[model samples]
Target: MFRDTQSSWMSTLRHDVPASLVVFLIAVPLSLGIAMASGAPLAAGLIAAVVGGVVAGALGGSAVQVSGPAAGLSLVVVDLVHTYGWRATCMITLLAGAVQLLLGVFKAARAALAVSPAVIHGMLAAVGVIIALAQLHVVLGGSPQKSAVANVLELPGQIADLHGPKVAIGILTITVLAVWTRLPRVFRAVPAPLAALAAAAGTAWAFGWDVTRVDLSGSFTEWGFPVLPQGDWHLIVASVLLVALLAGCESLLCSVAVDGMHGGRRVDLDQELTGQGVANMVAGALGGLPVAGVIVRSTANVQAGARTRWAAILHGVWVLVFAVGFGWSITLIPLEALAALLVFIGVQMVNLGHIRKVHGHGEVPVYVVTMAAVILLGLAEGVLAGLALAVLLALRRLTWVTVRKRDDRDGRTRVTISGSLTFLGVPRLTHELRTIPYGAAVDLDLNIDFMDNGAFEAIHSWRLDHERMGGTVVIDELHDEWYALAASGARTLPAKSPLKAPDRWWLPWAQRRRGAEPVTVPPDGVSECLVTAGTREYHRSTAPLVKPIFTELARKQQPSHLFITCADSRIMPSLITASGPGDLFTVRNIGNLVPRRGSEPHDDSVVAAIEYATQVLGVRTITVCGHSGCGAMAGVLSGGVRAGSLPGLRRWLRHGNHSLATFIETEGDRLHAGALDVLCRVNVQQQLENLRTYRKVDEQVREGKLELVGLFFDIGSARVHLVPPLRPTLCVKPFDRPVVAGEE
Candidate 1:
């Protein structure tokens, strides 16, 4: 009895029409500019845009992503055209489309992400530099050289002999684009590219300047079919593959990025690849340039409220209608204006923000080297060089290890080795063990992941030599039992290693058996896992360092604030408050909740704790803190645990009923925005109000003898936000207190 439901047709038309118009307007100038930059006919750019929008939009996985000729692939197109001629380049594009289609059919689209981002961005940046260099000659009304170095060498001559009218138009276009973004919002509704084109074209006409313009007299009527490339068979195949992989990577990455913009549906990368391949094939057959997902139009589509693929298809229709009916107007746009647009775009591709972001991750060397190689050598060479460097960096990080040696309290030496253990670490292991006294007892802690036979034998031989001189050598494996397995004559271990948790505590509370012996730090040297490492650390360092602070705290604890919070291990009151020892008397429970007076069973524990904290401890302030992503708030919101499953726990959650009710009454309609986060804040405020139901707390508050506050801690951000209560608002607000020092 499954029935299909669909949204109203009116709703579809309402959203898609306006979004289509906006994307269409933005695509017109960019398509032409990219085409001009790639040395393809102006009609080829329009053809690609139309095919990308209609074909890809209808068949692609991403709903809002728009496709067109991309500036990122301009250099690739230019190189192919120069080597194979325009018609043969179209055949290469066709072959690339076939390759992409095969790749999509095989479901290998997601593998495209295996390439390093440093290499990708570097490749793009190099293309940017190349485009800017070549387009600079075009802007100056001079023919561009084959390579970037030649362009650089002849750039001074072009500048010296710059055509006055063309140079004026180019400068005016660049100037308009640079300043257009800073104009008033009302004046900027037109896309910057269109505005720059209009300004340059208008100036050329008004001043009677002789500037080159786009000529598309018989483009559609005289378009011819593509011919096969006459180059070496292997080179032709390689050229096809280069186009396919580059276009595929660009389109896939753009789709993934666009997916983050909406919550409607995730991009199906394989389907998107198939759609792009199909679009490229169609465009190639029509003598158009290679098509890919262009971020400019895609972003515009999303921002303009596109709800479905209809907007993308409609955009293509609009472009087709305009090109067929009003194609004459396009010829009026000055060539220098288009060159200036490409130059601006090319400069922007070498993004300072992107460079800074990758620089922080220590990938600047790869990015810089790739960019240099691309400008000096070529696109494929630069990417391969960057990928090689990135691989080396990854391998170095994976194989890194650290070894620490310290003398124990009882005249024995302890060695802690961590990370992967292989033959590479054998020399360091041998040198360190030999430094220990010949007759001294030794404690070896192997906190390693994997161990090769060479590392095992080095340690085994060292232990034997020490024991021959009457020295006791004890070895403990903190993680995997590498030594034990080796001793049992197993040369190779299982590929899947054991799960190792932090040894903050030796054993779980529920797992401890009766009569289990207490784990102690060895008198001679401590060599154990993380569970006992804290106790050992305390014995070795912390206890002595904090002796004075603890000695004073032991005498008296007169805390200024009585902090009540959830039992979540991450919510540490002292850590947040920057308190050393006993600055706050604390109470931890499931939800940081306070029940109404005489309302619930099993509420005595919380009531008594508050009573003792207030009446006995006489603390000045009482703070109830809640946190984001709280299990208790989420449980109450979602009913995650059944009352039958944990009756006792369910009874305790009844205290949160008022908080839930308050949230529904105040902000229920906006729950989809952030339900758990809003509930966490509301619960903190509700508990503060509940504290007033207690006569003692109310009396103290009224008499100016106490303060009540609510706090919210965001786990991911590590920020504490003050919650404003609605009822019986406190005289002293949470923000009234100065922020904790050094938190951020």
Candidate 2:
């Protein structure tokens, strides 16, 4: 495995050279035009190409992908040059490079997620618009212009500077080139640029016509020394930012594309960004334009059967040789053809259909992003806005406040919350506080077992907001300790549940598009097994978790807690509880069974776990948890799963559950299905003492570190709950409240 990883990197060089040569054929003319457009030395573009291809190739995370003075950054470079002084711009570029390197070192790839999708679209659109306009001049046999307006205004410029001979030559070359590109298999093997350049130059020489050509005098000196342009630090700084964005976006995108095509591991986004930044900085210092990954050439390389870095290196060598040796041949070709190709690329960038789809969901927000992308030409801005919209949605979901308002005995209002708090729930919490009845003693009874930092911080913020009004937020059983433990705290955030959210967009779409039926796996142990509770059921299937518990129980090592769960028929007690036959000494219940001290119990299961753990097994850590959306919970809440349907259930659930009624009695109006997660948790806490009545647990807990844990399991959600110590009070989903921002 280690050698395979090492060898994969080694092959990057062997495959890159030939591919680079093909890309070089495509890059030379583009480099000069883009540099000319940016008002930089023509040679600077070639320098950037070398750095992006050779240097970036050497340092980048991926093995293949072409890079060079990109057209995308030309406008930004020009503007920065006009504003910051090229020297200061260069300094900024250097700074940007340093920042990228630092980011990579710190593993800040996640930072890319912070950039709004809107800004990215806007940036691309701006680049596309610029390309379309600038290319029009080349298509019309004239120098490129700045904008759509300028391209139109300069109609006379092409007429006045009309080089008829170059125009005729360029047109003929383009025609032949197009033919050669579209030819059948045999002729297609010939490089289009080779045929186009040879024919165009040969035709120009035969006619002996005056035409524009590349100026290579400044690019070389005695014995072909590298001729560099003089620029101060400011220009470098301005250059780097444009280069950084271009390089970062392009390289990462290339990585994504290649990963898909090659069935390889993902590209290291952070590493690639840093490599790009460094490559741009090196190119700039060497008097080159900025560089970024180009998909067209990368595709070409891949299609050409490139297998190693040699292809890329050879391509760079070809670029250098093409420009330096037959440097004068390029002057014979006209500019119109290049512009047409760029225009085609620009058109591809605008996805109007995508825009319409986006607008359907949120028009205002999508419009703002589009405007930022098209009008301001700010890629980062639009992207940032899009990201902010997503964050707002997430925060609204996390910081939800469920206010269960029930009528009081004296006709007053009673409120209780039996759910989690998270950043997503923030908006609901705020909304609930605003809807409170005026002049009522808001009995804010909270029982949250699953909370996170964002939710915790939001709770703190809400407290200030809620207290500002006349309402009292009495937090009962608030598990702040779990929420306070910075990273990877006791309970993690819950994923969108199929049972709760039902928003798996891709799943159904994939099935429909593929026109395939779903596969069915044997449900040996699932949700049904999670809720089924009884000692006899434990011995039936000989499930892995039940066997050890049974053995230990048979051996007189009684378990301390009665575990009630869903009867999905998939959950094996031994597997979930991680016990062998004689270990757990357990009792099974549909919902995890914890009998309240005063609650009645028809079965001895609840008492069994306590007796086993305390008296026989002498174990600690008695935990009772309800798996997510226990059919029993749904039944009791919906009045469907009561013991009447399953006689034993109606009888057994009496002692093991009470949180639903407790919430309805205190606060029902503000309560919603979101708390289904919490209700399961609260039931576990209520049952902890059902063990104590077994008589052994009460004495053992006082003597040892015997801990009591309450949990809720969801059938579909990937999150697990850990109710922290909120003694003298019981809280469910407490981790949802926010006391500090990223404090853990």
lDDT (10s digit) by residue, model 1, range 358-406: 8999989889989999899998898889989999988766566667787
470-504: candidate 2 lDDT, tens digit per residue: 65554433233333343334565454211121123
List ranges where model 1 is wrong by over 4 Å: 1-11, 405-414, 425-443, 462-474, 494-499, 502-744
Best by TM-score: 1
TM for every model, in the order presented, reads 0.70, 0.49
Candidate 2: residue 395 Cα off by (Å): 6.1
Evaluate candidate 1 by giving its C-alpha RMSD to the native, one decimal.
15.1
- RMSD for all candidates, in order, please: 15.1, 19.6
